[model samples]
Target: MEAWLDGLPADSVGLRNRGLAYGDGLFETIAVHNGRAVLLERHLQRLAVGCQRLALGHDATLILTEVTRYAAAMGEGVLKLMLVRGDSQRGYAADPGRPAMRILQASPPAAYPVVHAEHGIKMFPCATRLAEQPMLAGLKHLNRLEQVLARAEWQDSTFAEGLMLDTAGRLVEGVFSNLFLVRDGRLLTPDLSRSGVAGVMRSELLAQAERAGIPVWIGDLRLDDLAQADEVFVCNSVYGVWPVQAFAALNWPAGPVTRKLQAIARSLLDA
Candidate 1:
């Protein structure tokens, strides 16, 4: 399907568009069900934060309106909302006064093996590491070369997802999802203050877990923690949650905590 540029059907963006020129933009991948965008508020909240951090001014109300309308039209699928810094001249300095550009695209819902969700999956240990850029940390910006490279590290069907670490070798996240570990009835996830995308599903899980009286920890995580974890799972807005049964020689079961959170995530995505 063709994408909508500023709410109009378009085949291409301007050559000078900053998003095309230098990846100067942010994007959100949303799951739409029953004509509604799932976890829309959280997605918009993250987009707003990205705009603030990048100094890319945008009308939140306009985006919300457009996204709602687009999701309704889409019915059921994945909706991608991209906000760029508009067009710019032949220079690095962006036009501060220029209005941001909005691009929306819809695609069929993702298809993954049902067994992966039910029986769990194996994770590939990616050699590519995320760089610590505090300025861009936790923002789903257009520049995603690190994740791209990390994902390319695996081609085998056996590994459903790849685990990424920081340049300092601290576990950060999955290539396109958030990583979580359950130990002693407590939930632990890697800190994204220095690297990684603070995924929408990750945030939602943290909030829901806390509400359910689960102890949550957001701090540094390492391979040692993974070895000690009783349960491991990876989550994203698109796929909900997939329990990680194996990562290298280490193995974990789809323990109670993982199943509880998986059910919560399933309900959110299927809602």
Candidate 2:
């Protein structure tokens, strides 16, 4: 039995589409606002970069046209665009001339557990470690078994997210959102050079913090650093900023810094 592809169109693309065959692709989940995507350009730029890495071509204007059309049809919702290496015969060797296939889906944004947000999140020290793939780091690629496993680490709804570290035991990010720690009045986030997806809201928050006169340090972080952290928050484009209230007994407040960044994040959402 073919499982349903949720939120995707019923009109099927070929089953042999190389992307389905090989997972040779990338995707971006963008929030459409007021009939326009909040950060459509950035998402497409990331998609183009992903295509460039695989030697597949992407026409920015063409994709933009489709995105505009899709958003127009979907109205205000999350639009996910998947770009994949085009159909090809079964082989490990990629054909240099292969084009790309685009698949689009739209859905209402997953309503965040705002009640948990109000009380703040309960986190798990996830056992799953994200593999450090330098070539694939910072790209939202389709190969996400690591995330899938980490997400399965805790089924308890009390925990809003899970903290995933690298193989070296360095705190990298959460299961889905980018992490931030406040220490000694400075903001610190993990460097995505070795691993983790460079999130859109993560980049925006970093820049916004700088503009707000907050200094940021991006480097490897140990569990101890996070444990001793005065404030901690996780962010994604749709959720804005959610403070980590407790991580397996380490209690934290939605402090002044978290609230300040929350205000900044809300402004971007309202924009």
Candidate 3:
């Protein structure tokens, strides 16, 4: 079977595509609602940072224009924008002159269980831990073997997500979402200095919390901290916000802070 790249038809991707040969690229999954892409600028900003760090040449303005057009046409769906280093020769070194290719796609947003957002969801601690790489710390690069392995640690629907720690046993993030904790009336999230993707929704929530007078802190968190937290939540662009009803045997009520954040997220995301 063949598919289209953006709007043009393409039978098959080139065999030497750098994204396939090596995960040499970046991708952004954006949520669309009422024919609009949510947090589009933030997504582009992250992609730009990734390009800069990875030394991949990309036209940010062009990508933004393409995404805007696609989002408006799709009306409501998930937009995945993948920027690859184009084709490369059979070697580890990349050609500096190769033009980047943008694979734009749109699909229906996932229909998550209502209980997950309302009553909250359960999480299990995964055995797989993320390795520290300061150079790749907060970029959502195409290389996601760590997340892939962590996600494969479980297969049941009982746990909506799995919590992954760093090599030093400090809490980092979920398999696919950014983790946050509310403790002693303060909002806390793991610092992504050494690992983890700095999610767009996470940044939005932090800004919203600040404007709303919520005490927010970003630092290294421990399992004991989660146990002592007054409330816990996880967020991503697609799912918005999901309260953590329980982790292992320790359970927490969805406190005011989490509910407030959820309300804010709904206003911005649910449309």
Candidate 4:
């Protein structure tokens, strides 16, 4: 098993460590399968992009290398890398010269009960709306209080996830995963341009769609739209893809298209 860090130091005061003062940081939850990181390059790319956007020092390569070392020793599990502006003093104004400080960790695999894959999951609409922030949209930033509160709507194990809507009442994504729906033989997904995390699995599925000649529509969706969907599924890097068996009164089957995508996702994990 890989070792861990309890927290950062006390003397960690720099006018640049905005993460401690204002949660000015980004993070990624990566799946380490069979001693390999699924979509390693893509995750690194996204981390780098996030650092650039936050105006943090461009040194994601160093962090990626550190994560790779821990993943190599941690065996099969999950890896999380939190990159934040280094110890910045008591304000939001970021110091351009402060280097980014990163916290890297590896944890025991989240036991994704296999039953969810076979029987599917029950999800509920949450009262908390996903805030619209174009600058932070699609980036896995630390300001995830919305997800934290939305997920608190229930503690039922049977309901594996929560479906959250954006401020505009448009279907955004699950509390922790990207969502896709099939209707009239067409596949549709909420565009992350306005909100939601652009999950690694979502990107993989889109690539697979192109390779399979499947056309996907990225658009705004509402509750009635999902109710009319022929099938529904949620995906993340680790969970792969899970077809929604039921959400509220709506029911969906493990549609043929979803099955195919799941197969591909499994293959990636297996590889």
The prediction achieving the highest TM-score against the true structure is 1
Which pairs of residues have clashing backbones in candidate 4? 14-87, 14-88, 14-89, 15-88, 15-89, 16-88, 17-86, 17-87, 17-88
Supply candidate 4's per-residue lDDT for 127.
91
Q: Per-residue error at 120 for model 4, in Å? A: 0.7
| Cand. 2 TM to true fold | 0.93
Error of 2 at 246 (Å): 0.9
* Positional deviation of residue 15's Cα in model 1 after best superposition, in angstroms: 1.0
> Roughly what TM-score does model 3 have, to 2 decimal places?
0.96
Off by over 4 Å in 1: none
Clashing pairs in 2: none
Q: Rate the local accuracy (lDDT) of all candidates.
A: 0.95, 0.81, 0.90, 0.82
Which model scores highest in lDDT? 1
Segments in model 3 whose C-alpha atoms lie over 4 Å from true places: 1-7
Q: lDDT tens digits, residues 149-217, model 3?
A: 989988999999999999999999999999999999999999999999999999999999999999999
On lDDT, the stronger of 1 and 3 is 1
Scored by Cα lDDT, where does model 4 land?
A: 0.82
Candidate 2 lDDT over 111-142, as tens digits, reads: 88676556678788899998888888998888
The per-prediction CA RMSD against the true structure, in angstroms, equals 0.7, 3.2, 1.6, 2.8
Task: Choose 3 or 4, whichever is better by TM-score.
Answer: 3
lDDT of 4 by residue, 28-143 (tens): 89899777777888788787777777777756566667677767777798888777776655656777887767776778888888978877888987899988888888999888
